[model samples]
Target: MSGEGNEPQAIRKLQPGKLVIASHNAGKVREIAALLEGRGLDVISAGDLDLPEPEETGTTFVMNAELKARAAADLSGLPALADDSGLCVDALGGDPGIFSARWGGENKDFNHAMGLVEDKLAAQPDAPRDAHFVCALALAWPDGHVEWFEGRVDGTLVWPPRGTKGHGYDPVFLPIGYDITFGEMDEPAKNEISHRGDAFRQMVAAVF
Candidate 1:
């Protein structure tokens, strides 16, 4: 998928117009839309367009993000943005790095997945409880040009979970320098320090 010179050219700027968000997860789409608000671009999700969800065959976040972005761009004839994010645990040696969503099973039942996490950690009481959330953002053009950024926010795990504001593992991950889990923090506060937020800001600076 090389562009000119047998290499993909980096997109230095994104013109103000319509863009496709290559994701079907409603929570993810909402968060991304909120981030891009007031940026003079109309954002539409792949789900809204009834775009088929591509299989995420990549083993890493960046590769998966690029795969999704490119797939959406090709289908929509518009610049596309995609994010691949997950929680990595030090104790588990990153068991769920690329499989975070899979851990929730086909139904995407995160409550059961969280319980599994708690159960696994319980068996390793002496192990480190540290963990982090990682997010990789890819911006792809229909011509095969792509730009990407990755960000992480370190934190620790908490048993029994907490709060109900955020979804997925938010209720169990307590960010560094914070007394409350991500589930307890308001959207504005969480966005200011989230891995996705960090990656989005970098992408904005580089391409927008």
Candidate 2:
């Protein structure tokens, strides 16, 4: 077989300890850790290791995720998992897709960010309120081996952002077939159908 054919076939499975989550966001770290529960991987956050976050200069979700993952894996000398996720609103022409966190500004205030989303949507009342949450997960080894996965959950963007549970754009996002927002659901319930969960499951099957 050619090297090209064997390239993707090389799977680097995770060892049962000390995997780093390459993010400082408390919400992301907690959610990802929860999804990783019982997987035999000891999950730790970049914050826990005091690893400085790499600048996410990549445009797409996958690129950014890979950047973060590689940075952590190199710094911590451990396999690292990173997630780059966002709520993309169709009405806004996918505004804030990758820039979702930056929409929060220096304070990382999601309430302000949600209000901006609402304001933009409010300007165009005729536009569809449909949106989707996108998550890209990257698992990188210290040796530079990397595997990436992406997932999306379609939903609607609601006004008066409901619920107070989950973080980020959760309060305004109502997943399909459910009247409640992600912010309203408990960790277990949210983990079952989340974009992060979708990506996490794919990584687990391939890497863990």
Candidate 3:
């Protein structure tokens, strides 16, 4: 922690040990944990540790993810990982990007959020349904070292959202070349090509 105003900091590597997943969302935590299952590190969540969620004042996914990860790491005195992801509809002007969770209202009811997206598209009637999901992952250390990675998956939005397996906007998202929505796919299948999976892969390659 003492090194400051010196040469550029080298990218830190994550050693196998107790790591914090800095998020309260159960679905996201589960997905990340599954991705890390084969790794040797023990994983825990910010929610499990009762760490207060930091306000996401960052404008981009990477910024927000770093914010959460650093906060958790500093508070818990352990290396922490955080993910910020969202659905961006091109027709909606990339809306619900960083505000994806807020679109779900107070309880984070994504069904309602999906409906809102549908309604917005309904009003347009002729706008393209092209959209994408972006995920940003950040790993932070208690000493303030940080790493960031980002991933995106392009797709189209469908009405009458299908399936109930995956969470968030998964039911309405049809990935390119896939007939089934993410919600219709199993965890392993979804993880094979999800935005979060992409980011996680990058982190694992560089860190673990």
C-alpha positional error of residue 26 in candidate 2 after TM-score superposition, expressed in Å: 1.1
Off by over 4 Å in 3: 1-9
Model 2 C-alpha lDDT per residue in residues 55-102, reported as the tens digit of each score = 889999989999999999999999998999998999788989999999
In terms of lDDT, model 2 sits at 0.88
Ranking by lDDT: 3, 1, 2
Model 3, C-alpha of 14: deviation from truth (Å): 0.7
What TM-score, over all chains together, does every model reach?
0.94, 0.95, 0.94
Candidate closer to the true structure by TM-score (higher is better), 1 or 2: 2
Q: After superposition, how far is residue 72 of candidate 2 from its true place, in Å?
A: 0.6
Clashes per candidate (backbone, < 3 Å):
0, 0, 0
lDDT of 1 by residue, 92-165 (tens): 98967878888999987888888888889999989999999999988888988888888899999998889998
Runs off by more than 4 Å, candidate 2: 1-8
Tens digit of lDDT per residue, candidate 3, span 1-208? 1112222344566788999999999999999999999788899999999999999999998889889999999999999999999999999999999999999998999999999999999999999999999999988899888888888899999989999998999999999999999989999998889898888887777675
User: Clash pairs of candidate 1?
Assistant: none
The top-ranked prediction according to lDDT is 3
